[model samples]
Target: MSLNFHTMHDKNPDIVASLARLHEHHFGARPTVITGLQGDGSDRQIFRLSSDANEPVIGIYGPNRRENEAFISFSRALHQHAIPVPIIYTYDADAHIYLESDLGDVTLLEWSNQHDDSSSVLTMYRQVISWLPKVQLTSKDSIDYTKCHPFAAFRREAMQFDLDYFQSSFLSRFLRIRLDNAALANDFNLLIAHLLRAPFDAFMYRDFQSKNIMICNEQPFFIDYQSGRKGALQYDVASLLFDANVNLSHSFREAMLEFYIRETMRYIPIQEKKFLTFYYDFALLRMLQALAAFSFLVFQKGKSYFMKSIPNALQNIAFLLTQDDCMLRRLPELRRLFEEDVLNNPQALS
Candidate 1:
């Protein structure tokens, strides 16, 4: 789990040197050392490279070639839209090195956890949503999805997030569950199919959540946004509001969702009824996605940090399933599994 940038630099000394030189050229001081190693879900190693005279620290990322290009392209697109993401100073596509602005250490999650009152936190979160439409519409026209790895190309990789990993590896193997119901298995497969086919035409911050968002100088700044893509807008909203990691209350989640809908209307031409429907559908899809992810964390990764969230995750899933009879009927076994196994036997689910 420990990220070693020194080792990464050793593998690509030339690229590292080029980054250091770029940092010096941009900031008028050579970087002191690379720091910070707690980033998740990325093969890239993020580092805060220091400079003299209170210079803005530079972020260096070591990733594969395609992601490097996407990061560069996406960063430029966001910048053009006046979105508060980091500014890229330099990039070496071949070496997969990215030199960019450092937004500092105080993430939205850290700020919310530190304060007693979340009123200010909520305000900043709303501001982030205010900026979302600009990011979505502007970025939609700027970046080319064909330039990066396509979602269709990731079909096999996406399946890793489905029952194959969750049930076979995590549940059956790690949780030691001897699942008796074949119907439950069928429903789970159906749910996965439905999600994989969900419309993905908008520019999406694939990992939009509190942790990747920073509150610097009282303004919300986006970080770890390189995984952004052309995906459902509701997917990003669900990622933020229903975030299991930060654990915001239901009241606050509702308030934020309302804010998003109202604000999104100002930019997009969608009707209120259609938008509301999409919101509920996306919420259900996201909750089911989280359930699968939580299952993986507990059963495969052995991360107990997600155990407490399972009940709430199942509750959200249940709430969403109730919205659509087709979804409910199609995934009836999943509904039963949630009620009988998850809702009733919280201890077992945990």
Candidate 2:
């Protein structure tokens, strides 16, 4: 999964020269700097290219060519539907290099952190909520799900992927917690069946969170939507509200859920009561997936910032665990293991 991008290493003269050539060919001038940007969990290498003559552009070098293609194709579809995404100026499929409009450095997460006022935060969150339904409902007929990376739908198989990711990456690798594999599998099956029963009619922004949202001129522009797929409506909302890094307040989360329900009704008819009922189910599942990712990144990958999020993720899981209506409660063995391995042993996580 090696990337073919340039950075500030003096030893790699060839890499640097190649990047300069790319900048000159694209923007008519060699970039003054091709600074590498910090990455999350993905294997992709992102660089910010800037020059005196040309406006700033982002040059992305991803190892997986298919994922890059997914982003380019999906972004174009979103742009066509008037959704805000970084405009893909050019992409080289053979090299897996992508050059796109630079949406600037401010993410919704960073922007929200700068403001302490609760009302202001809510206002920003509300704006984000308003646009989600549009992303899910708009261009419903036109999107080619085949272009979605990995899969087209968040179906049972896709749900299983997250479950398996948690089991192998977190439970086994990070926590070193052995489990009754059969029991856990049974529980996973039940949970998947329940989620599959939810309304699966909209385009789910698989990773709809504050960090992936860029604030360009105070307006939200979506990025990193390569994982977009057809899935249950509640999953996206859950991802937004229960985001580990953001950790939005409980009251605000409730308000946003209602806002999403109301906003979504504008585009399609939904049973508010039913949607509300299934929201927590999705939220709980999303929390599991997120924690699994956090565990892998923090523990296995040795990325320390993700460790700070463990407490928040655990807190969210604890809250869900206490709820009598929780679908996860049905799996007693899994519950006991999680309670002992994760919830009860908070000292180790810290």
Q: Give the candidate number with the greatest TM-score.
A: 2
- What's the lDDT for candidate 1? 0.66
Model 1 C-alpha lDDT per residue in residues 284-321, reported as the tens digit of each score: 55565566666666655567777777776666665665
C-alpha root-mean-square deviation, each candidate: 4.8, 3.3
Per-residue CA lDDT of model 2 for 1-350, tens digit only, reads: 13344455522444445656677787788787777777778877777877888888988877898898889988888899988889998877776677899999999999999989989888888888899999999966667888887988999888999999988877787777878999899988988888888888898889998889998888889988889899889999998998888877778888999899999999999998778667887888888788789888877777878888878877888877877667867877778877877777754357
Off by more than 4 A, model 2: 1-7, 10-16
lDDT of 2 at 117: 91
Give the residue spans of candidate 1 off by over 4 A.
Answer: 1-28, 150-170, 173-200, 294-312, 318-330, 344-350
